[model samples]
Target: MEFTDHPTGKRLAALSLAALGVVFGDIGTSPLYALRECFHGEYGIAVTPENVLGVLSLIFWSLMLIVSFKYLTMVLRADHDGEGGVLALTTLVKPRKENMTRGAWFLVILGLFAACLLYGDGMITPAISVLSAVEGLGHITPLFKPYILHITLAILISLFLLQRHGTAKVGTLFGPVILIWMASLALIGLHQVVRTPSVLAAVLPWHGLHFLIANKLHGFVVLGAVFLVATGAEAIYADLGHFGRRPIRLTWFLVALPALLLNYFGQGAHLLSTPQDAFHPFYAIVPRWAIIPMVILATMATIVASQAVITGAFSLTSQAVQLGYLPRLRVTHTSASHKGQIYVAPVNWLLMVCTVGLVLGFRTSSRLAAAYGVAVTASMLVTATLFYIVMRKRWEWKLPVAAGLTALFFTVDFSFFAANMTKITHGAWFPLVIALLVLVVMLTWERGGEILAERARGLTKPLDEFLKGIADDPPKRVPGQAVFLTRSHNTVPVAMIQNLRHNKVLHSEVYFLNIRTEQIPRVPNFEKIELERFGSGIHRIIAHFGYMEEPTVALIFTLCRDKGVNVDMNTASFFLGREKLTIGTPPAMARWRSSLYLFLSRNGMDPAAFFDIPSEQVIEVGARLQI
Candidate 1:
């Protein structure tokens, strides 16, 4: 169901609560480490009263300007058919190749790279978030310090292993757990703020301005740590389709923003009085009697955060596959009611191994924090760049207004990005490497599909010519029906031609079906199919689906029936082409990329399985292709 379908007050409230678990988990949990990092991390400064106020001012204004203004107010409005994300935003500006100008192509690449960066961010978020929560055990007692790494690996492994069981059952508890978590943040933080009301002075911009001037380069370097506060701001936009703009905006204003501000200021207040607690400010705010319970709650909150990121990766992979940027992977739907709750095994396991490796390698959240902000800041920069294009081109805003807002966003994004760049040698290079590798794969798959389509067009005859030739020959007509799946709408399918050549007989009814993934999020049922008759019981049916949808044979047939065309499932056969790709002498792509593309092609999910066709009635026609 679309978020717009439910506009009732009760339903909106319910959705906003659910959004808290899924949308705000990452950002909510930032209080666990953000304040601590600014004073005790790799580039941390002294935790005097002035420094406390300065860092708090930076955190407060960052959240207000970047998360509040840029994302919730501006970026959230740029949804593509109710879907907000880099991919959705990319399609809005550059929907089709025919419409793509040089500038559009550059934006598209930036968007794809932004998507790749998320994968890297996805890996680090789980490791660092969970590790930070688990490290609270160290505060409980020094004894747990020796076993923090082992404990973190266990939780991460269990989390990934549990993905196969689906989150339908566990998801019910997410809302309540996170609600309590946010409340705790506010309560504990408010307690400290009451004790040290002087911390409120940081609300003014001058303290942060003075901090930067006094510290100079060191203060600028601290932005890498300050950027952590809003690292999950993108999640607010990414999950826009799930909860809609109204609920997300409402939740942020009423619940998330207030609670976050309270907690951050509370931490600042606590630091002003007890500077030595900078190493563990978040936990220090908790009462001694409540430390164990708080740790448990924090761990749950982090798991919820990690779950959101993992699910996002799966959704992103699905979108990439449908949009033809990646080869098809096995997608298992875990919920009948929610099409978005899907699990991709390859993605799940790969993430687990990498996350566990990160925990093992870094061994502490402080170290992992060094590797975190680089990719996220880069992604935010891309989002800001695309948002600028969206403003000028899609929204058609006046040049001065669009440029002014975008320039402000770019100033913030680039500053954070530049600050994080200094961390490359300190392990920030890991996500960059991962993003580059994934970008190569995506670009290779995209380019390879174009080359293959060009070659296929060269090999196949036009549909009209094929039909005319068949009419003249008058091939023997057989009983029942045949369905041939093809990529091109104008050209004849290789499988249909092969069947006609070998079997020497035509079916009574023939369907040349082509499935197209459109740039939107979801296409309505009435607008899905275009049917045309080619005489002699031959027809061409082009099925249109959106990037967020899965096209199935049964659904297509049902739509066809509505259009006055019927085929008995028991008597129908589905024909598919299985292409064997080989490197041509000249090579259509770089040698390594061609090899990578070939490997991906060979291992991709079978067409029959991908389209939900019955395996017993499927026939594969093999063909060889060079390039």
Candidate 2:
């Protein structure tokens, strides 16, 4: 909606090209091997022209229905401010209650789990795409077979080496390369289609249905294949903030849609004409003279897809920090022009290492496909569930329609997940392992906070009463106006209450601020903030902000004036506690995980910037505690 920070212009054509480069990288490249897998599932090969065509048709319609109708057209409009990730969406849908209910919180947790699954997908995408491209070496010459690993390693290493520099610098090449890749797909597929016009049958959705209804075993594998085509569809919605809804919709309808269909149909035709050439259908479609160039182009496209996912992971992590699922880390804004463009060093290197490990371990796209769908599928299901809640609760859509749509999506997604479960022994474990580890860390941080909060309540004093007591004394030594930002709604922080009781120091006109996030797109005026007066100049200000809204200290402090709470911006000293969580008894996690949380928390983004509080005016008091 904002077209992000950097305005790229009103020329729809240029934006479409950029969208193709950024948004469609994952789904566009699925043509390379998506079809080959449809025929070669876990059981055997019984793919016919009708079935393949049916599968391709299913892929097209699935993208149209799930991605276009469900997400891009509908869900993208439901942005929490201009942000469009799963977390933002979840925040938009979280239900309000009198008490902090676990049921409402579970939705947030599921959305977080979906984000974790995406990290797994992020690791595997580059590996599988690059490996699949490089594996074309085997098709070229048997001698190339021996050198596949070296070539793949070189390609992957080069890709990782290029990460420090932003994609904007090299992005001109992505569009043209992907365009060429699409052309190659069409050219190869067209050759086979001319030989057997019957291959055109795959364009019909009913054919895919017949294949599914008629053949049970092959249909399950086809779900895995269909899953690939829609893998990056979620990016269209996630990146809606980047390119805007119109640009992405236009690109998907005009350029991306045609290119993908032509290439898929071409591949289907090629396979039908030369059924025995099924060993490597995509590469076989190209002439000998064009094969090397195809491989190079494929390599380039896969790298682009990988880079897009890599950057996406960085953005998601940054958002997670803002929303409090992650600990603060060092986030360096990479782009001078784009506030959304960020570079997280740890995320970058970790991704590069994990991707390289995945590429080497899987060794081929066919093998990597096993791991691909599970994470994406799980993510899709989670998003669908969240969206249903948004429709019913937020948008006030009819219960039946919302529930039916959600159930259909969940059924499809879970079935694919069940099918991929069989792939666990294969390289699929890589993503599952990554997802579980991330899930544990996320839940651990949250649960640990609850444990600490409970402990703090017992030990801490009533902050309002404490401040009132200090005000009654009228200490001449007390400083100017003060604003203390806190995470808890009740009484003094354990850190501060302990500090004052043992090491007594008090300030006049003390403002206790509690910044709490609500579970809706926007907070109503009634829910904007709550101020309850305490005796003396001391006051408790509980500000309820939607997760979508940027929490600016300047704005909130100004609003405090309207509510009859006074604070001098220049003289008001803001105090915030920086909790350094430690391992102790009544453990929320295992020792190793606690160690990981400590490590992650230490590296998290500084709290000063997170709250938009100026560093010079803010005093951070460190508190060591066990969660």
Which candidate has the top score in lDDT? 1
Residue range 1-627, candidate 1, lDDT tens digits:
288564558998889899999999999999999988899999999998888899999998999999999999999999898999888888887857777788778889889998888888789999999999999999899999999888888899999999987898899888888999999999999999999898999999999999888999999999999999999999899999999988899889999999999999999998888899999999999999999999999999999999999999999999999999999998899887877789999989888988999988998999999888999989899998888888988879999999999899989999999999989999999999988988889999999999998887776789999999998998999888999999999999888888888898898899999999998999999999999998999999999999999999999999999999997776699999888889998899888889999999888998999999999999998777888
Q: Residues 301-407, candidate 2: write the lDDT tens digits.
A: 98888878888888887666555666765666656665555677777788888888877776777877867787787788888888888888788989898888888
Error in Å for residue 80 of model 2? 3.3
Output the lDDT of residue 102, model 1.
85
Clashing pairs in 2: 53-202, 54-208, 189-266, 328-604, 328-605, 329-603, 329-604, 329-605, 463-492
Candidate with top TM-score is 1
| Candidate 2, RMSD to the unseen true structure | 4.3
Q: Estimate each model's TM-score.
A: 0.99, 0.84
